[model samples]
Target chain A: MEQPHGPQQQRPPSSPPVPPAAGGPAAAAADAPHAAPRAPRRLSRRRLLKLGGLVAAAGGLGLYRCGLYDERLLPPGLRVLGRREAAIAAAVIETVLPPEPPPSPERVRTLLAAIDAYLLGLPAEQVEQLRWLLLGVEHGTFWFGARLERFTRLGARGRTDVLTGWQRSRLGLARAGLRGLVALVFLAHYRDAPAFAAIGYGGPLAPGFAGPPASAARYARLLAPPEREPGW
Target chain B: MIYTAEHVRRDRVLQADLCVIGSGAGGAPVAWEAARHGLRVVVLEAGSYLEPRHFTQIEYDMVQRLYHDGAARTTADRAIHVLQGKGVGGSTLHNLNLCKRLPEEIAAQWFADHGLAPLQGGTLPALFAELEQLLGVSELGPAQANANNRVLERGCRALGWRGGWLRHNRRGCVGAGFCELGCPFDAKQNALKVFIAEAVEAGALVLADTWAERLEHDRRRVRAVEAAVRDPRTGAVRHRVRIEARAVCAAASATGTPALLLRSAVPDPYRLVGSRLFLHPGTAVAGIFAEPIHGWRGIPQSYECTEWLDLGPQSTRRVWIVPSFAHPAGAAATLGAFGAEHARLMRDYAHMAALSPMVHDLVPGRVRPRGRFGVAIEYRLDPSDAAQLRLGLVAAARLLFAAGARRVLVPASPALELAREDEIEPVLGALSLRPHTLDLTSVHPMSGCWMGDDPARACCEATGRYHHLDNLWVADTSLFPGSLGVPPQLTTYALGLHVGRCLLAALG
Candidate 1:
């Protein structure tokens, strides 16, 4: 089955072209032996209309089955992964990014739901590729998960350890994928959630972090450090 | 019972010793100064104050939340895309934090030509010293620099093009390389953290989501300012506030300040109020390398080329090449077209390091009032400026190739690509630098409302006070009499500080 290109699809060369009836007025005057005869004049207009309708219906059905109506038209399932893989992936992300104080389990669940929705919306071919990518993550996490689960479900400290290890090994590809997925999840949650407000993180939030404070007292504090106490 | 002010419904009057409008680079500092001087300063910001914690690590949301019109605002001719910040910190909140002082030569030119004698040698040095100390401008170390920047440095060194570390107003910057998205780490120093926060703490009353409409003048003096306050979240009309001050400063930036004055009909017979606009047009060159550059993992811009600044006429627009990385959507939009080929490019995201060279030209644009309070700008790039753009593009392409770019994309119509070193010049030479064929944008916009000795040629006087109006003053980039040839932030701050002192003396 051929995939549909944007708006300009070409027909196969084998298809016959529709021509005017041969052996009619002009055809008869320049007639050669190969000129075909005209169709019978007795055919009704209703019959012609019925035939056209049938052709249109057939074409529409063909286009629909070829994924013209659906964005994701998968080729073949490479593997049948278990829900446990997805769950384990979520557990790892949570471990890597421990929720801050006002922690809401709802936020995590919402984020997961959003990621699933985004994945479902992707093209079938892309979805297949992404699933493969996720499998790579699953493989890497399998051994790590067992050891992590054995020790307090991997807090921020443990997550940092895993991240640092990955960085030192120069696993940039895996890190990019993980970062992309995490960013997407975080964005979806922020946009969908009503309780949160967008923050100005990039450009100019504050003056130079190391510059003298606007206030004299604050400036002085920046220069001084907390005093060390005697050991008890 | 529902009440109505003289002009608009749902009105309330607020009083303060000084009322500052717009809370970005300019107003933020002015408010801080006034409040610190024991004056009751009220800052009216058109955008909301967003906290750092609320900033997401995503590109799309970051742009939508931080950028003006989600980074879609442009000139009427669409020759240049202008990205401004709308939230509390303003454009400072979304800037790359490239802080550099205005060149001395440019300062001297303004002083001699425009009669801005105050900005002469000795005075200029003192002002710059104060500005630098206040802003904490410094250079990024090798550890803070990213691999992407190193590629530019390597290319410049190989080709013998001068380059050095770009100074930035930052401290404790971990180099996340997300400066364009608003620094989540609070490392990039913007006015909000330094000036605005300090001002608020110093007893300045900042009213977010309030837009000043028109000035209420009594003959030759501005008696008060009328504004419409709205809830930023819902866009619902909250109330109308009237602020009365002995001095009124319009620090609403290049675009906003001009629109305000034009709406108030502040008499400019010269018709130069919103004219002589200069935008440092820039374009980027992306290089794909074999090794993982991880461009997004380091500083967004840590290096630049100063050698190009003194390049003689006919030399292409010179600029310091800096490293940059965008969010996925932005990356995709810039990368152009989506498919398996695009996906392969994404796979090598770690290998891509980008450099943008910005050019300065004397070609001026004008801003006209649209309706009553809005503004519509018209810009036309001169032939010489166009040539400079082409020159910059060619030079950037060569540098990328020298740095071993497997593939380079030039952001122009009929986008040219170079795979080999030999094909670089031919591809760049074949390109047209016409205004319509190229994609140009500006982060720094100055000289829309100029200050000069002659009111006939300038919008305001040397003191930044409007020609006819006694107490009305302009304290933003709009007061820049001409192009500073470098970043305008330091000059703007210095001039603003000078204007404040002048206002104080006059009032006394």
Candidate 2:
């Protein structure tokens, strides 16, 4: 394969190993480059995240002139998640919750809007990390063996399998990405009253509640307004 | 006169007898007392004034309005998410009202070890009682224990654990479950409603969306507090206000208090300005029960199990187990699964019940400012604290099954769901205690400016006055010598009142 083109892009070994996401140190050992055993204590999630960052940044090398800065290519009104990233999100969320009744088009738009809002709310560095996560997952199809697969090329079944692989993949980076995206989708869907009602939760009881709602008047006598000072 | 910075059109200077910074649980009581005691008080709050009208009760909107960093703040390395309140009322605006006096032994330890005289037996209890009365502290009624809490309550009973209704600082809380989302019902009696109202009523001035830049101080005392009046929404400084006060009380929380002092170049002779910072980091296990639990429906944190609340100075630390429900935003953020499995778990959202297991920290942490843009908290899990969490999680999982949960979803990174009760022990035992393996979060951040008699040992003195400056006092959770296994709002209120009384005495 042509040596990946970028400052930090280097071809990882032919076989990219997979480790279980749980069982902390034991799982992290799978990601180590060499067979030589090292203390798992020294291998931290922060360090692993940093490594993932490097890999993701490198993955975006030839994807676009500026993979992230290429905003003109995106469908209008979409800020952070462009056509490619948004498609990946749509695919991933659908696969995560493939119910008999798939979410409506409006529901999908709402979820994506929530995600965009969340991404916008992120600190600048985190925003880069999330964007990189999206790009890396997409680029994995091309860079990693055909078995690893790209997001666009994968069928619905293939997409689900890839996500499952990531979730179950001993790589902490893949796990973090999957977890974060899942959160964005789940929260956006479930934060509303209909979501609560579907789950059988009676919504927050307030104005109709029998007890005296916390009123400042309760302590009016004790904390009555003090005599105002003469205009100084 | 009270000024909302949203209306600040130009720069202005204000003067007062005392200046209290950050109107949270720590500052409000002091402001209330100061103004009530005939002192001209000026309060500067960095966040906006989120009243019930402003509180939309929507998760996303509420977080943007109430939470510091918009509920997205994480620890320095992004290991643990930190949830703190912002706006005029500070954290009190949105805190789940689980009120507890500082655990007696922790207070006693401070009194004995650090010579925190005011924290001795009756001193704190009296203050606690006074504040409790004023704040309307009461236990959750049977009606208030919704299905989610009922799960925890029943589970504790099944396990023969000592757990029951939690006392909250609320009055007429009509089970408005969105307590963490800034109670739109105006049910939660936070400082924003009680003390702040009293503070304003009693001839005190509260500058909303105003940030204190520096304590203009010299070797002897703080001369004036220089602040910026900014647009609450944009945080763009629209005006400047310099308040000259006889004394200053820093209640800017554990993070903000130290940051302010460091920014102002205040005296730290003992190098103890930002040391001993503590966040009682918590992780919860969610259970999907057969019945619709609707975890987010009622009072969020109205029940706790004290079966394992071991406060003794022993090898094992105390673990406080409680049902901690979340608004969809926070809940979604911590979910460990992705794809169908993620949807599968969330699909049972009405059936999801969660338990937050927390521990008192032995490993003292510190907070450091990263220039002016942000602050980084340095917290490493003490080995025992980690063990306590593991044990607590196990206990919680077992209790869930005992309460008849179909399955339990832990906060584990790779997604751990105990589908069968039999798998609980084996699965829990297999896990190791790495920092990132769990979804770690902290709602309580305590003890950045510890109070003690020894100038060389602690940051603040017995009366909550800073050892370095004569006119500077601290009346916040920053003064706690250590983490309280329970919620610190009540203790925060009591401590603020205690320090306010002391400062009043000194000033007189």
Candidate 3:
């Protein structure tokens, strides 16, 4: 065995030790005058998942280069969801909603805007969980749906298939991930007034009452004055 | 008087005889009673103060404004949806106002099993009567049943199942059909419009948009309460508030109360603070009728069928059925389909009626504090409870069919669509009770910091006093020894009053 690098440099052993790198401890050992020949290494599940993650990230980067994930698509002053996450969310909205009469570009943007507004009210921890959920759904296509493309790149039928796979998967995480995204989509889509007209909902029951205010100034005006002054 | 984050310019301090952590059904009465006794009281509410004028009656907007976690708070595994409310009045701001007393059987069970004698005592009934008078609890006539409630009523009559109209805490209800989204017409006589108002009039200072961080305690005595007043739009901590009080009451709901206790690190040798959580988990069944049901037009839930509900600990049937409908957003999210199929179902929105079977679970779940102001709920359905729910689903389908529904849709994965009565049994019989297989939501989350004689098994005494800490008390549904197999708002109000008196005596 090789005695180079002063007794292997005391490196922590990997699960299945990484294949020797050039000028590394294992490589130094292999290249030693008395070292034995090395055998072929087999890949483990953990290693495969790491590799998948890198490959998915690379695929995402490639899609970004293609201008699919435009950060400017998100409106200014978004407190939570990132631009890439918003793009993925838009794709999800397109996939789950009715395809016969496709949603207009403006409608999709409105839904995304509503989600962004909604996320502003949640705690950062929950919003962080949501970001992780989006990442999993985007990169999990190969693992869950046996597709190599990211979620945003998966066309309508492919995306549908992937979502169906998650909905029926034995793993609870997969089912929950799909459910979280679908809930977000429905929440934004069905709240729009156009959706009401399509479904025959007569909107709010009150006559002179307006819906949610469009600006902060309007919301302030809507708040009623306090009943009495504070004792302090 | 009330204050929000906007009213505070910098970190401030207050000295009070009593400090209440919430302004809900539980905390409001306590504040009112204590303030009336000339005790300087300060109340901290985590949500913003939005009166009737602020209520938009829009599902998305109100859900974000009034509900806990934008009504997106669910179990850790995403198995069940938990709908808790935030705001000056807590859940009462958005609750349907269905007021039911704790079942007699449940009270007996608590006394027998948990040694909760006070719950089964004579004092509680008087408290209930008084609370009812104050809140104007009354029953709607049979004529008040809209097409949605009528479906349940007609079905119960046709099948000879026990059912009737329930009482509510509303004084000027206008059938706006937007009770779940706070009442825009100021119809609901909830804690906000009733007790909290009275408390403010009695000089209790309520600080909305204030989040309680921890109870500064010295082993047995809670010395002070530390909190942060957050900017409403950005959720940033704009001001800090510290209150030194003789006593502190935690009226944050089941989830909120337990999380607060755990965060405060109150002495609990048994680790019983956040354990024993029970969610009255429920799922709905939709029926499509030839006549337009227009289900979302009147009081959301007024009538209920109790054939399957018996509040005994060992009872076989444990589901309470009520007419459940949703606005467009909730409907699209709950219905079991997507794309063209879901769109087709939405077209029949006006012709659809719904019935939800809420289970009275026996097994307990848990709640843990996630961060400073967040909760992590871990709840899974017990097999027995799930079986009862399945049975309730079958019964709901039968009722809808009996009421002349053209087609009944059970909101299950591969949603069971039954056209005839014969199709109900075999279809739902084979349906699995797994998490993703059926859609479930819970409005009532109770009994996390439960009350009992055994300190090892309970978080508080029957009088809402914490055993480990003398000056700390939990006065919300967190004090329930077991699941209250009914809407718990009315009992919550009564218990709040009881705990207030207990604290008043302790202070004296």
Candidate 4:
């Protein structure tokens, strides 16, 4: 039914080269529309194992990372995070979304509560991935594989450094988890009023209307349902 | 009467002259026209009737309620993020209300490739004009163009490119900027307001929270559409509803329509039923401005720069530079930055002006039906399409600089943060097509179930009738032969009208 050879696919037309601007790589890239496909950045299966293999090593040491979050300590809305997991999440988000004015204890509680609610509701697969990401972030190390210090144990600056390192890590798994957590935590914070206002966002399309909806009354003609024939 | 499946205590059997699946742009129009003609019509909508007053414009809430899988709909590989809408109004409820007719070249492509005679022969323009009048397609005025949109226009002027206001199906749009979320002010003339409302007024029975499992069809025609009435809050189905109809039109969407066909076990003679799908994968490059653009305050996507939008056959200049102002959750989802930089990006969310420089993609994809009421979309931005996005980012970065942006965040392979205007090219030029590097998001998903004269190459006829299944028709963007390089709401409406007319003729 199909041919494996020849120009079987219809390729998009090449654009007339964008007139180049002055600048080195960026300028050259300004005209960089159609380039040969480059190889995807990937860590081999061995590299991924190298990144996450630290959890088993910790298990060998009998340092249980499971149930790190305390359900009772979390705000009423939250059910998933244990005390330790909640603390580390709060710490991680503090670095990711550093609030401008120092937050009240209540403010911090609300943001964390919102995050807990979001995490608790994630679909089964995403929850698994989030948990895995949290474990890696909270436990993975700079030394070898995800086997570094517990993230909460690291200083504020150290936490930032560790997250950056993971972002820059060759292992795609580490990067995926890192990005996923950033999005989840980032959105969770923005959903809170204090955090939302900090970013200069106002919820709801401000009810600034010029007038009520006006139909051209295009269907006014069809209102009478004429007895005219529709046959062609 | 609108029936929610959850409260239906018994299996209900309903009948209509025409049964339309999905109540978005496609199904709503057909249902309206048929019901207007005094035909008994039944419309089945899987999503709930999320009315305007209930449209809490909060990004998180809207995504959970309106978007498919809470806007977490993705390709099978979880690479590209799909942004299809759900609910009685379908995606139109959350869509930005861009109502462009099929571009002339794309119309010709359909005629030549798919033998769509109606798209030619002066048929399409008349229908397009009809839709325009009905939907209130207006050229956005200067007042409606928000600061986010002005930034793109300013850049286009600075670069001497053809850029201006886009026409939208809005009546008194007060620039609420939450177009991705449902418009609370009822300013958007989505099908819920226009076609579906009219259809309901004309006595079309609309069933919400009812999921059509499959079409009961023989080799020649669909017998009855079997659906489950469901609780809007819970997935529990309380009753079953069977709608026996003279004709069935699948307008569920580019993804849902084909899935319905496959679920019905409809014969695919050409083996092209759910193949060769096209979605315009877009990537937004954010620019931090010194001035408080407050990009979220006004109408999102009012202006566009079409300088490099070349959609001719085999042409690579396939990019549309459009304004993209995002609500918090929407903005954070496809943001390419991670870690502290992502946090910093959010910090400047107020000053962030983004341009969704999207690519006109041609690489085809597939939509596979998964678990009950679930579908898996598989699409990839091939190297060429990825290359198109790379150039789009370059143009966007320059536009930001021209618009007096302090810094631009380029979501490139080696994502660049350029402060100086001169850094746009070298930084981008140095980057290669790390194929999976782009944060691809698409609102326009088109061309899965194609229409053509040939039975082998195309799935259905230009008349919108399924070739193998006689009485089943398609009335959605899925019938499109290729990408239209523009917002497709108007085209979808006209296609629905065309199909409805054809069906009327066939029934007579």
Candidate 5:
């Protein structure tokens, strides 16, 4: 039911430019709608990854040297992350998590599986975007750091340095990208049952205890009889 | 009747007197009001209908079910995490149920500057009272304050600062402490339990798992809505749907309303659809206490510190501080650090309570449609707003120290851990407020499709109707002309009711 694809697919209109509020709190100047932010570029992560692939190809390196399908630990049924993407994600997870009490191989595999499930649940476009993010991290050493080696090839110290650089990068895009990946790692790592147990969280309070139920009669008065059909 | 995508086996065309494109605090109230007025209402909810029994209180599963993008949505810059609701009740499903009315000062500004005359002359107060009664809004007493909330109260008393208990819309909350992940006991008097159910009772048809993709409209009036009914689990489109209606209300969130507007390419000559976006962006400050604070066991946020909050246009301080704690998963994400330091913070999860200082920001951001059914949010804090947030952070640290925190954790790159009260100012004051430098999150994103008298300054009329279209209206926080320096749920409900009345009048 989309409108004819032409001008409609173009970038949405940007805010009219305004000078910064002079000598006043933004709370007041917000009415002036001051200091319109720079218009954002409508670049897809997929397109960015393609450009990165092209850059690597132009650097006298073959596609294989750019770390494609290198990590074959793509567990069964994960349709989103490819083998190399999974390897890069695993490396990023290892670098980003706490070093002490190192995660076991089993634990890492579990985390990867959790991440796969989470990614699988997202919209297809977002899954593609996240795949590109993993790929970008794997191949971004030449751009983020001066090193030409892939992220997975780097040792612990080198990988740490590269990730730290991305985290603190002046380019907002780089920081944003790294932050997104790290957030995924943390979300997967900390949302599990063992993590909850480690942090003394009791998980959900239902089944065992429903927590004093709210007034049933009060809500009962508000509901009308169900119609004959539940679907229209 | 409520229908999910599973019930729709084929592409269908339906007709209704009103087609509302969301079912949150905005859309549900309008549907209820309209259905009660004998209008054939059809509500399209892009998410499934989850009952209280369906709420498991599990953080990860609930977030996946209730939140947009599985709770991973961020601004285009990826600096700020934008947490919005996706289910039938929208954010009311997960919100802490804090009920605060729009400040009169901001309303006066809208009236005087934006020509929103209906806001004044005792119109809004009456409407607010009606909504408060419907939702059973009540002020929490000291008895309701948990150990986490007591941190704020004790801090206020120790520092001689201004703070008090907040009002909420829960009737019989047992303090299960998972408000951000849907309520399990159905204690929250939210849109799902109240308005949407009542609307259905009044004969409105709610189509769950139905995504409104476009508004079919001519130059003057919206004639129909085009939608896709998708599988809730896989998001695979099952059937195409079109609902021809006399009126359409986009009660989608602030981000969603504008994205829908731009996606439909409705006649917007002034280019005002998604230009002025405001997120009351906030960051949490965690305090390490000697004793256990079991911060996740009781009512999440009952106390608030308002010493630093001023709603005036030229006010220096505009931070609304409240006790904010998350589950173990959320806490780990909020706490910064990658190595042993991160482990050390997690060990003290049982002894930590946190406070979030939300800025009453004025910096306008932008929202545009990205890929189909995706929202591209472009927002960055201006220097003034950033300064205000920095001050709020400092204030939060001071309050934590005053309440006898052994150490305070400021979520920044290489996170600041101050052990002494004197170290708070010297350490936090020099911190830079940049995109990725600080961890900022927003629960409130508003004012994208704002209302005003002038066409140049507003997308909708003060009556919440689109100025360029006759039968189109917006009923959400997107109608806010400026930042509401307070929780926007009560106001959103009131506006939905107001718009519903206006649309009914127009229909007549």
Candidate 6:
């Protein structure tokens, strides 16, 4: 049976055979007639300097094209989603699953940028699908939030009845929207949060709820209202 | 003994009837049994003793300090992750404290086909009793389970998967969710906490920060073992030492043992050495729930589903869904590109539950020796194994959806998210099992330097003695000739105990 490809195949050959020298007896006699005339060597400091400058300029341009520089390289649609939609999504996610003391503005911005970068890197088809999914979520959350506010505005008995009714039909939709919203927010915030801690993940990776200022309670207050707010 | 004023000098040489190479699970119990029988015993360990205080909750640092290859070792062809631990306790130090014994059929096959004595009903029961008493293995109680494990239990029950609480070698665990990192509390009962400690207390000298380089022999009988001592942090060579032994036991795991033998040029013409390797590639399916599951607050993998074990030969599949957690770097790597969307996912961490299916792989691989003492493994899932992976993915997705998952993320390349429960099967069917598309990993790698009934197809005999060498023996998982269809640590330890006894009797 053929062996699976592994390190032995990937490593470069230990040693290559030495090539015959150009001026050896065999080469000199056999190719004497056809050998081209040797070119004269000259030192041109100005030319050398010009060549170095050109190489440096090319290298800088190459780095810029690789998305290493500050300016955005993605298409306008993607750039807009990264810059604007990401922030809005993060804010909305904070409201949906609020952490205590809420994330700082810088933290939220970092989160948005990370998520935007992540989404932008995806295949065009996936990005399109995700965009549609997010749009659906945005619409659902908007309606759900409006309905919730409307019900809260009613008298206590009225609020209770309306909530009980919505629980039957719209609860599933509301839950789905909340999940989408939370996922988007987490993907965004996790990029900026400490490497050990995560919002929704509790695998071997979660840093757990410890450390100094980044208390879970503080994060909750920052993201959502105190009562009935989701805390991760 | 070489000594100066700082070290006591003795011109005397103390000898043992049998000298085991490692003091981990495979070597520890054997040494204990041998020593208990009034045999002079010396157990050599390559790693130092790590106190409970040394165990940290830091992912990067702990993995570097505790895990072999610093947790970056992977198969070359596909990014199949591999993890092993190095230290006084071996892999038990870093493992998730899961214990499982091989099924009766598998044990019987070993006996019938390999000429090893059959581990019959009573024999296996006695072995289990000895193992349980020695390792303190027990099932996790409901009160000891965390919310995440409970969610797994609920999911398995909802899907009617044959699942049950997993037995772990732990005591007084506080649900720290840092088993992979190294439990901060001295709750995990790795070899260091139990066997190695007892061995040391019983006058076994363990040389830490040492590597057994090669085996030296006179004709067929082994004479001495050569090793090097170095600084653990810098890896700078400190000293070279040699221990003359009457016999040497190689318990260096499946990968390490064969590589060591190959490097030493101890000829076994069967070409079966370092072949027939099995890695149970596993993957996790993450589900987003409506409520906080607090997955990190409980036993890492308290419950498991054995529903798929008897899926039959044609199916070539087995799956168990267990609770799992991820550290930040691991989470970030899995989360892919980071930013606002990723951040949002992080915020809802409490509402997430990850279910992993550990599959039984039939496809075999090989481990080749490389540079100095290093090993390179090559493995590829065969067609049947690939089919099993698809089945496993479908099963995992169905269970997650049944457990009230609003959305589930599949770890396939171009990762897809399942929104509705109905989309699970179709999406799973569409997945490509090509190396690039799948995220595969294995914690249990076995059957490399395997034993067989005949000299033509095997590296060693039933007693783990190399066919060509009278005094050389293997006491590690490498001696397993085939897949056990379950975790092999307990079985490895039992085999070690059996072989150690046989070697002593033969010597006498």
Q: Tens-digit lDDT track for model 4 on B1-508?
A: 4545534567888878999999999888889889899899988888877666566666655566787765656677655777888787898998888878788888777777768765678899999999999999999867788899999999999989888789999886767777777877778889878888778777887887788898897788899999988766445676788999999999999988888888778999767878878889887888998888888888888889999898789987899999887777667655645445565677888888999888888788888677667777888678888888888989999999998999998664225689888988897776654534556677888877888988898888888898898899999989988888888889999999899899888887
Sliding window of 10 residues with minimal summed lDDT for model 3 chain B = B410-419
Estimate candidate 3's alpha-carbon lDDT, on a 0 to 1 scale.
0.84
| lDDT, candidate 6, B393-506, per-residue tens | 888778788888899887653347899888988888977776645556788888887777688888877777888788888888888877777777788878787777777777
Error of 4 at A47 (Å): 38
Order of candidates by TM-score, top first? 3, 5, 4, 2, 6, 1
Count of backbone collisions in candidate 6: 57
Worst 10 residues of 1 chain A by lDDT: A69-78
Model 1 TM-score, all chains together: 0.68
| Clashing pairs for predicted structure model 5, backbone only | none
Interface RMSD list for the candidates: 18.3, 6.0, 5.2, 8.6, 4.1, 19.9
- Could you arrange the candidates by lDDT from highest to lowest? 3, 5, 4, 2, 6, 1
A29-89: candidate 3 lDDT, tens digit per residue:
6657687544445688999999999999999877654446744345566657777888777
Alpha-carbon runs more than 4 Å astray in model 6: A1-232, B1-17, B38-40, B118-121, B311-315
Best-performing candidate as measured by lDDT: 3
Candidate lDDT values, in order:
0.62, 0.75, 0.84, 0.75, 0.83, 0.63
Compared with the true structure, what per-residue lDDT tens digits does model 5 show for residues B222-266? 889999998887777889999999999999999999999999999
Could you give candidate 3's per-residue lDDT for residues B1-508 as a string of tens digits? 7787777777889999999999999999999999998999999999998877677777777888798888888899888989999899999989988988878898888888789766666877999899889989999867677899999999999999999899988876778899998887777888876877767777788899999999999898999999999977668888789999999999999999999999999999999888888999999999999999999898989999999998876799899999999988788778746777678888899999999999999998999999888899998898998998898999999999999899998876545688888998898998888886777899999998889989887888888999999999889999988899999999899899999998999899
DockQ of each two-chain model: 0.02, 0.14, 0.30, 0.10, 0.20, 0.05
| Candidate 4 lDDT score at position B404 | 90
Candidate 5 wrongly placed segments (more than 4 Å)? A1-74, A141-149, A154-158, A207-232
lDDT for each residue of candidate 2 in A72-169, tens digit (9 for 90 to 100): 22234666776768866665656655454665556666777777766664445666777787776666653333454467557767776666666655
Candidates 1 and 4 compared by lDDT, better number: 4
Write the residue-wise lDDT of candidate 2 on B154-226 in tens digits: 9988989998788998876666577777776677778978888877878887887788888999878999999
Report the CAPRI category for model 2: incorrect
Residue B103, candidate 6: Cα error in Å is 0.6
